[model samples]
Target: MTAPRLKVFSGNSNRPLAEEICQHIGMPLGEATVTSFPDGESFVKINENVRGHDVYIIQPTCTPTNQSLMELLIMIDAAKRASAHRITAVMPFYGYARQDRKDQPRVPITAKLVANLLVAAGANRILTMDLHSQQIQGFFDIPVDHLFASPVFFKYLEQFKGDNMVVVSPDVGGMKMAAAYAGILGAQLGMVWKKRTNATTVETVNVVGDVAGKDVLLVDDITETAGTLANAAKIMRDSGALSVRAAVSHALLSPIAYERLALGHIDELITTNSVPVDTRGLPIKVLSIASLMADAIVRINNNESVTSLFKIKGF
Candidate 1:
């Protein structure tokens, strides 16, 4: 294989993960300055020569969403102007994915809008993991390598699999993911019927499958408020579940979510380090995806197939 002239840069969103990935790949983090003006406008400058080099910008549009997003755009433009041969947006946690569809009248598909913005900003490709929905990939016309955190999640879960295990979806929408986990672990599949009363509140009406006296594993793509997962855990415990644990790809957990986790409604909250989570004072457990992401980046740089990254038996 030919050596890939690869370069990895990062924005302010998730610098620690980027640094870890760079370390895993045995490459120094690309030099770039990402800062904002007093008026909240983003400014970016590439400190090293990147002309004709294959560049990957690691930036997750997490908290302070707009500013981070703008920073990514500016960096992409900067790389393009510096004559980079290829530019890939490496977003571990894809934000604005919830606005993928027009569910209501006058609604905007901001996910699609973000895609357009990236393309317009001179990104040649995208590398992200565990989007809110699979269809969100269609929002982009460029090449997209969508990855899963299941490999990381499954590795951690392998230690806890037993005969009394049951994999559960926090809501009906996540049933498919739950079922896959169940099949892989040889556990029962269960789902909670959840009703969204508003933007922040969710009610678990009932459970669809048998979870009685079983160790429950609740799986979801992401969680922000922790309301849905916490409520589902309470309902499952009340319904005779022995223990309840949750595993999510992206945990953009709010302060309330941290409080809930501390209160112990859920047994274990296993998640990937896709975003910057402050687990210092919480009972949440985070698994590293640096090696997985680093491998994908290397493969992409070499023009190697990335299909195997998505082939989780239960996912």
Candidate 2:
């Protein structure tokens, strides 16, 4: 039997990234009308035929989180009702990921709720990159193909490879990610111990491992207010490090984050274009993951293994 025809569509959240993915895939984005009603309810209509076709919808739930997420769920429902053979929701940046668990009383596990919502809306599979926690995949009953942005970061970080480099995790929770980058770059590993003073504030209590006289590369899965990174960078500099930089997979830069970044604690902020980012004249470098995601989509469509994509040397 022949495979289902593949068709890709986009919601309003990240049309540019979706267009770039289609460009890399050598196909035009499937026609879809995604808009809102006067009362702000989302409306979606797949303009092209997708009956028995393999469909992929690209929409990252970034800022305006609820709206973007609703759009994705609606789009998935539309595809399901249209009789698509298989529908994969491609979320480059999964929002509500930080709320994976209920750390506080009377709080809900919003991440798990989001997963249940997606499955309920009829997503057959999920393709996302670098979730805040690896275990978010368990929230879904459907097959989840989680991709990493490390390959893209590794290629760009080749110039920084040297003996005097140290990969530092901004906090203890990210030590594993920092260790992976350290191994891949052949650098030393370090970590920061922090205490959360409030929802938007962080205090760095101590630093582990040697970073003096070394070029520090702080690695973390996400950053929003820049508090954690900025605080960590300040300590690294004060500790006599040559220079401090950060490699954050997702840069959810808010106005406060921009203000903090402008303070110049970190020399550079390297991030992926998983969401819309405005550098605002800061030393921020945004790398494209369009090609990487496009390659994964192709492999998935071909029923081939995507495990090889994670095989970075020493990682």
lDDT of each: 0.90, 0.94
- In terms of lDDT, the best-performing candidate is 2
Per-residue lDDT tens digits for candidate 1, residues 1-315, read 565499999999999999999999999999998888898888899999999899999998999888889999999999999999999999998889999988999999999999999999999999999999899888889999999888888878987887899998988789888888888887888888889999888977888888888999999999999999999999988899888899999999887888777778798899988998888666689999999999999999999998887665442
TM-score of each: 0.97, 0.98
Candidate 2 lDDT, tens digit per residue, 131-222? Answer: 99999999998999999999999988989889999999988899999999999999999999999999899999999989999999999999
List residue ranges in candidate 1 displaced over 4 A. Answer: 1-4, 311-315
Model 2 CA deviation exceeding 4 Å by range = 313-315
Residue 30's C-alpha lDDT in candidate 2?
A: 97
Q: Please estimate how well model 2 matches the true structure, expressed as its whole-model Cα lDDT.
A: 0.94
Residue 134, candidate 2: Cα error in Å is 0.9
Clashing pairs in 2: none
